[model samples]
Target: MENSTQITIENIQYSLSDIEKDCWSRLVNGAVKSRSPFHTPAVATFGQKEISLRTVVLRKTIPETREIRFHTDVRSRKWAELLSNPAISALFYDASTRIQLRLNGLASLHQHNDITNDAWQKTTLSSRRCYLTLHSPSSFSDIPTSGLTEDIEQENLSFEESEIGLKNFGIVSIHVQSIDWLWLHHAGHRRAFFDYTDGKYQWMIP
Candidate 1:
């Protein structure tokens, strides 16, 4: 028979297991490093020369190295800010789960090389199709009445073959210093902050 018992602590219902908490942390980290488009976060930044904010996918995460990766176009406005100041912040919110993660870190741009080549090699043809568009990302122009679309399937292009796009493709990495996680529960609220700078982590006042 399955165990059927109602238990609550401080009016909050949860399984009494530290493993779950540990697993959740690992899962969150995995999401931060996921390659899939669905796993990325919508990035935001303070305006300097201009407002620099856009959706960015999580390309890679190296725990040992303490780094996070994202891809963008070199011609984009965000790319300019990244060059001027590597400090950047990211915000993530999950409506279904009612959870939010705010992170601040230093950013770095990766140039085309063996490491970049490896990362580019994993992109799918459909994903690469996004790079085949016109180079100007946020340019202003008038479009003619006629429009055209290319048959991406017939391209038979490898990930590396998008040399032109790859040339413009910029990899932005963030070395996380701190991350604030907030969860809104029906019974109450939970908030925590993880600081990677020091060897230990302490709960922050929420």
Candidate 2:
């Protein structure tokens, strides 16, 4: 019989296969559109042993170039760790379809670039306000203060006063090297791995 042509939750069964190299190519190239409500990238950072997970907005993806981008605060612990060890992993889960993908890549910080600047500009005021805080990421305080302080300095303000807080904006770009996909079904489970370096995709025991 011919394979299912539709690419929805119901047709996902037919699309099951190795985490195709082309999938990685599309992800890296920002070709495959995101159907999940999470238009951003979800990343998992490894600590000494524990794991830190958070939603990271996808900044850019260049499949042919093998580059993926996300952003965060420079003062964050994740930023410090990525600097020491570029290797990182990001997980994308689509609960509606029971699909979870683990992506492995090397992450690099972009401190200066049009892309970073553009992303900073696009940031909403509520989000940009995050950069105005005096405390560093994970810093502790005796009392609770709003995430943003009202006393932003005039000299530090940007041309668009609204963007003044974005001075601390930091962008991270992850260059994917491999990907693994896991699918859970009522009858059985499927798992696959893809290696970009080798251009191969193979099924694996779940």
Candidate 3:
């Protein structure tokens, strides 16, 4: 029943480094595996007006730099909020693994640049549809809407046609400053806090 790290009186099986590796492993999998629980995380932002939270798909993760990336429409509210306030936090949880990760970081926006260009090149025509909206996200409409024109909504765009969406597509990168990891188990629970700024971590009572 036990693997690399097991529930113990002291719960010292996983070292700080091991925990960090596991954290990134899950994140990487989340980015590539659509079924993974971590594939979509709650991204939160604190702006001048209010605290905004939204669930976004995990597009990429770079462990070396502790950076995470997600795609967003340049006109989305979250994109505007991040531009105004770089502070951000992403929360992830895997029920099957009984693990939770909370990441605090600063966000940077990329548009019409190599970063966004690469991302756009990898996006499918269907996935690029959101960026072709007639109105910016959150814009009040006469009726509830997805923001796309009726014809565009009913058909898929060609690769050439999808090019127009690139103007509205952008990449949101989060430079992780710290990570709070938690493992839940019936026998006991384990918690750890990692401070990337100082490269230090410590176990916490769970």
Candidate 4:
């Protein structure tokens, strides 16, 4: 049988503004800490035939501008999708907290720009190896492959060789337009919605 016990959290009443503040705080932590539940979020973008969704590593969050950053390969379908239609959605959930944050935003790609340069500089050669793939993401092949040359995939490349991957690297920055926050509890579930573009917020049925 499943455990019937509800998780009890510490006491503290939160106002709407407090909840918003906490959301951004958690986002910032997620970008820097790999252990954070928010460290990886699912980002969705409009694709050619259907809505595309994929898991992305949380790179950075700018509360001042309500923007979130993620890195990707410029040759990937997602990068192309964002170029055609910037509309994007990001989702973050913390099982322990029973909290879910659903965000709608417009995403812009950055490449051969300062943003990409800064992000690229922060990454190690191992992480950059993905960019060294011989073909764009989702390219059909006779045999399955990671898309990287043997040396690159095997971590046999030096920093000089790894630099080649920078040409395929880029960053996606999302300008948050709205947020739907949901909380689950045994007593009752709570939900709130914040629309930045509309400059309004409200409680909603969970």
Candidate 5:
């Protein structure tokens, strides 16, 4: 499908140049306020010969640092891929708003560090279950399931029980280098590019 480049919310309209900062504000707000699947953006990383893409829940967005963060199991292939090559791109599209954000960034992994510890402290035990899986993510299995052991299938677990999984939990922080924003409208499309590395922000033809 074709893309659009405009922002129309309520009765107000905003041009790229006038709303660059506002666009980021809205993006961060959407990540926090919206519960839609679009909140889980698809992040792509380079493999040896191809690009690997996987959907990840947005954990945090820091506009001050131009960074985005997500959690993952250290054993996941994407973790290994990022360790090998930190270059990555994340794509987010809000169907209701018809806005798409393409973020290019460098990914850094945090494990067994203060950064991961702080994030872990804020993580709920329910969200920590996936890290308790008996097998590493994507491991070959004859059955189709979440890979969690039968004993750990319960929704709630004691703090001690959840501690085991903490060892595998890791945080990935993406330092955004650039953002390409596109908004679609029946009247016309609006597109803009923001390059943080070079301190550039400008509109472009869709």
Candidate 6:
């Protein structure tokens, strides 16, 4: 029999194990259903000589494939950083469950391709406005603005108007290689580490 434990978070019960499968299942559930911003993970990428971290929304999760996706502007600094180095780390914490997940993975960027086109097609016009900016993300400006052009009315933009933003849209797919799961409790803490590349799963002292 597989060793398991029952835990409750936000009135939902989960039968978890000291393995990658259960942990990944819970993570997918959190990303898809959790209303908290904790679902937005902090992704760290290799910078010039150091590591840069930024919070990004979790757009999709594929447990079977061990992949997660997030959208971004192709002109963003992080996009450039990922292009230089695909290796990255993502951190997620759920306050309600007191669970922390650290994931290490390789990211693939999709731009001006079928992947980007599919993602853009599913995005709403309002959300697409961010990619229609007159300048690339993080550009220096004398004045602060919403990033969109002064003449472009936010709510009035038509589908064709939003289509122009497709050129700036990009999708990032992270293929997870390892995951570290930690749970905090007053009585005792539990932790587990999983390495998919080596097919190893073990409990760690917490």
Per TM-score, the best of the predicted structures is 4
How many clashes in each structure? 0, 4, 0, 0, 6, 0
In candidate 2, the residue pairs with backbone N, CA or C atoms under 3 Å apart (3 or more residues apart, or in different chains) clash, namely 28-62, 28-63, 29-62, 29-63
Q: Flag the better candidate by lDDT, 1 or 2.
A: 2
- C-alpha lDDT score of every prediction, in listed order: 0.62, 0.68, 0.88, 0.88, 0.83, 0.82
Estimate, for each residue in 71-92, the C-alpha lDDT of model 2 and write its tens digit: 6888888888888778888777
**lDDT for 32 (candidate 6):** 76
Model 6 Cα shift for residue 122 (angstroms): 0.6
Candidate 1, which ten residues in sequence have the lowest lDDT sum? 1-10
* RMSD values, in order shown: 6.0, 4.7, 3.0, 4.6, 3.7, 3.2
Candidate 4 stretches with Cα past 4 Å from truth are: 1-9
Which tens-of-lDDT digit does each residue in 60-169 have in candidate 1? Answer: 66655666677776777787777887778877666666667777788878868776777667766666666565645666658741111344446766545665566666
- Which lDDT tens digits does candidate 5 get at residues 1-206? 22244455556766555567765676576467658545689999987789999999888888888888889999999999999999999998878878888999999999999999988888887888989988899899887888876667766568777988889999999999998988887887778898888888888789
lDDT of 6 by residue, 22-124 (tens): 5666667656764754468999999688888998888888988999988999999889999999998999887776888899999999999988888899998
**What number of backbone clashes does candidate 1 have, counting pairs of residues 3 or more apart or in separate chains?**
0
Each model's TM-score, in the order given? 0.72, 0.76, 0.92, 0.94, 0.89, 0.87
lDDT of candidate 3 over 1-206, digit per residue (tens): 34544433234566667788889999999999999999999999987678889999999999988999999999988888888889999999988878999999999999999999988999988898899998888889888788888767876557898789999999999999999999898877889899989988877888
TM-score of 5: 0.89
C-alpha positional error of residue 90 in candidate 2 after TM-score superposition, expressed in Å: 0.5
lDDT of 4 by residue, 74-149 (tens): 9999999999999999999999999999999999889998888888888998899889888888899999789888
TM-score between model 2 and native: 0.76
